[model samples]
Target: MAGKSGKAFDFSLFRRLITYTNPYRLTFYFVAFSAILLAALSIVNPYLLKQVIDKTITPKNGDLLVYYITLMLVFLVVDVISQFLFIYFANWLGQEVIRDIRVKLFKHMLGFKKQYYDKSAVGRLVTRAVSDIETIASIFSQGLFMIISDLLKMLAILGYMAYQSWELTLLVFAVLPLIVYATRVFQKKMKAAFEEVRTQVSNLNSFVQERITGMKIVQLFTREETEYANFKKINEKHKKGWIKTVWYNSIFFPIAEMASSIVIGLIVWYGGLKAAQVDGMTLGLVIEFIQLSQILFRPLRQIADKFNTLQMGMVAANRVFAVLDTQSVIEDNGEEELIHVKGDISFDNVRFSYIPGEEVLKGISLEVKSGDTVAIVGATGAGKSTIINLLSRFYEIDSGVIAIDHTDIKTIKLKSLRDHIAVVLQDVFLFADTILNNITLNNPNISQDKVEQAAREIGIHDFITSLPGGYNYNVKERGVMLSSGQRQLISFLRAYVSNPEILVLDEATSSIDSHSEQLIQDATDKITKDRTSIVIAHRLATIKNADKIIVMDQGTIVEQGSHNELLEITDGYYRNLYEVQFASATTTE
Candidate 1:
């Protein structure tokens, strides 16, 4: 959702954006120099026209006339060169500024707490990073620098006209109040229209992104016609938002054109009358004033249009700055470096809540010994996944102490802590890249030999070689090119290559076929040998060989022991859960 704030023109936002150009100050100065030169060169053509009419052509002086014409040609060449410099340098500054800001914004997002993304829309964040940054680029490339050049040119033309004939100059400016009033009103209406258009664009992006991601559900439910109708309604609203801007432009430009033409007409008429009645007022001066009149009023009309680019850029800058100002980052205050951990984990009086007053884990305590394989089984929403989330420090508990080897986890550097652990989530995410690169994640330390060796050790090397491209095969966006089971196997190879001291498998085999499950179980056996392992599973059959099993219900541990030991408890929670959640898996196995 995009919203509008502040006045029509926000000077504070403009000031903030200008500071981004500090790194490119030299290029900005060159652009400023070019604008000044172009503005100074613009007045020469009209002044030379007066000289030709009064001093050369009127006196029948052929030699002087040729000289003035040649001088005009020289000025024309310089003007073209100055315009080129201004355009090139202005665009360069704009592009460089946006590049830096985009990188900074992305880096900031990477450090944000998981909670921030949990509440934010992917499409809205995408729009801010891409479309909004492009809009800000227009401020320098087409808005601010161009406005300055036009304004300076207008001032030069006005000064020359006043010097030539004060009477006609005053008359031309009589229409100023009317043009200014119309421009102010146009700006107010267009600002609102542009804000609405941006909001609709973000909405359209979010809707399309979500629908495409969940397209299987839509098709399975046979909601194609209904979805199409909904899209049309959103598209219609987007169309209407743009149409409102066009309507305002359609009305404003015509009025500005008419006003400019009327001013030129009045200048010609009044200047002619003065030449006949007043002393030192000649026909040539009247003609020169008409040319000057056109130059002055043209920029006035162009300025109104350029103002729209400026206003839109300001609005976009406001949105980007808001994201940068967010204080939801998980502070990395840990000074302790975790070089080699012993893999012992402890939870003491841990109390946590995703939302206030809705606690997910309540004062639970547990200890995991070194090299032990612990399986946690629980009903849906019974705080099973929450344990993994806390162990990885993806979230901070409301009140508790979680430690590794007797040191509080809060004292360990985030990078050092996470670097030693690997998580293979049920919903595996793979980038659109080669399979080998996905496994190694392009880490230089993990060579091709190491990756291939790890894949073989995990028993997926033959499966990879069976594919058309072997490890070079491209897994399209989100690994859509691969089957669900194949994707799961790739995730296993990825975690294996990392060679983490601690391994976490969260329902890794829940959605796989029996063959894939067997492969995963074999890989799990090899990888978890003499290493810490935590498995959260709904299917009890997979965790039967785990060293210990912890049964959870309502955010509390209800049963804890080995598989046979837990079954020995008469009518226990683990027994009931196994009968209800794992019976199908057991029969299939």
Candidate 2:
């Protein structure tokens, strides 16, 4: 799927797109029926013109002229109504298909492994889910239905022209091969151009999204000018991609217009000569052939432009389908239903690497009893956080087994397994919503009363009520309205409410004030009282009371013991780490 080539007018891709319309098959049928009616009715206007010229006007019969005009007016009404229905249903079908695809694409993305997101750009995904899908909508609204209607109209005009005079029709048909050749070349070139355009669009979206997300870093480093210069390069590339399409349009349309003019001229010259030489070939027949030539050649000229719409749509569809077709690396084959877990966790010689050939966690083994509180202390890049990530099954380990209650974690259903575990990271993310909504995460089963009671148990109830709106306060994006310590307290309350059998806190109070730290310490005791708790912390002072402390170096656990037991060792890793890491915090406190 990654190496697939883009082919212009891929029939397989077209067939796949058609299947999405099956849900709206009845509306689609109405659109088709309306297009057919419009095509058939359109020919009546030119036929009426020929009748007025040859039968009514030429003979000077006012009564017949009035009757023919009445018939033309009736056809006009029907044509207008048919056109309206064709436009309405075609667009409606397009909107509905895109809505379904967008929902499906988002749902698929939600199931992807964390590693997929590590390599994917947010803006690139946004373009696929939003911009690209909208472009596909045009394939039906402006491309497919319109092209079909035009082709039908052309066929109807060609039939009428042949009935009027076979020789004149043949003359017009001679120049068609030239127009067809031009269109085929135009489609090929435009498709390649459209593909470039979509790529550039994704690139531009990715760059802007990244810059905006990291605006704080940009401002802190004063790299505004440098970043703006880089953005201009991407913006220019996007511009150039569109320019290529414009250049192709400029070359193709004139050639088509010229070909159309030549056909019309040929009709006038050859038909005029034939009318002069023959008896039945009247001026009325010559004029009707000329009018019919415009109808036939006009669509031919416009088809090239319409094909551009279809081509752009195909390019967008190719991108969107590429994402939809991506199979998640994490396969959830486990059918084990875990109704309850004892929270006993064991790592048996687990080896893992985020990237190939670069091991982050080497062959490591550890165990925590159902009710034990274990603290993992390590320097940056020592694989402390990786342990938590692996335990939560955010990424699969390369080798060995991770078990909960002697049952392999891989054999347990992902949702059910994760349901019994809750994590609080150093950096907490809160959505722009009421604090109560953030705590419950909109889970209808967790009522406001339940959340308030949980907050009180966690000992943050007084702090929350002190805020202007209490638990109903709007946090704004990422909880910017709250202080760092307040946000940490909110996260603790959130995790506590879940009432998980296992709780993991990674540097939960590392960068907070003493007041917040004291509150978190009080809350942490309440939350981890009976549950299996894993605390990954850089601040050694925070974990002095942990039932067991494991000191990690590089990817291996070098020491494990109680705080007093580890302190008894004169030069052990935990003793040295406590002096180097916790001395400052202890003095500050």
Q: Compared with the true structure, what per-residue lDDT tens digits does model 1 show for residues 388-498?
A: 888888888999899988888898888988898899899999999999999999999999889899988989999999998999999989999998889999998999889
Which regions of candidate 2 deviate over 4 angstroms?
A: 1-6, 276-280, 585-589
Candidate that scores best on TM-score:
1
After TM-score superposition, the amount by which residue 309's alpha carbon in candidate 2 deviates from its true location, in angstroms, is 1.6
lDDT values, one for every candidate = 0.88, 0.89
What does each candidate score in C-alpha RMSD? 1.7, 1.9
Model 1 clash pairs are: none
- Candidate 2 lDDT, 1-589, residue by residue in tens: 2114555588788888889999999999989988888889877888888888888988899999999999999888888888888998999999999999999899899888888999899999999999999999999999999999999998988887778778988888898888889889888888888888999999999999999979999999999999999999999999999999999889988988888789889988987887788574777788888787788878888888988999888888888999999986566778887777788999999999999889988888999999899999988999999999998888999999999999898988888888899999999999999999999999898998999899888888998999999988999988989999999999998899888999999999989998999999999999999999999997787889999998888998889999999988989988887777667766878
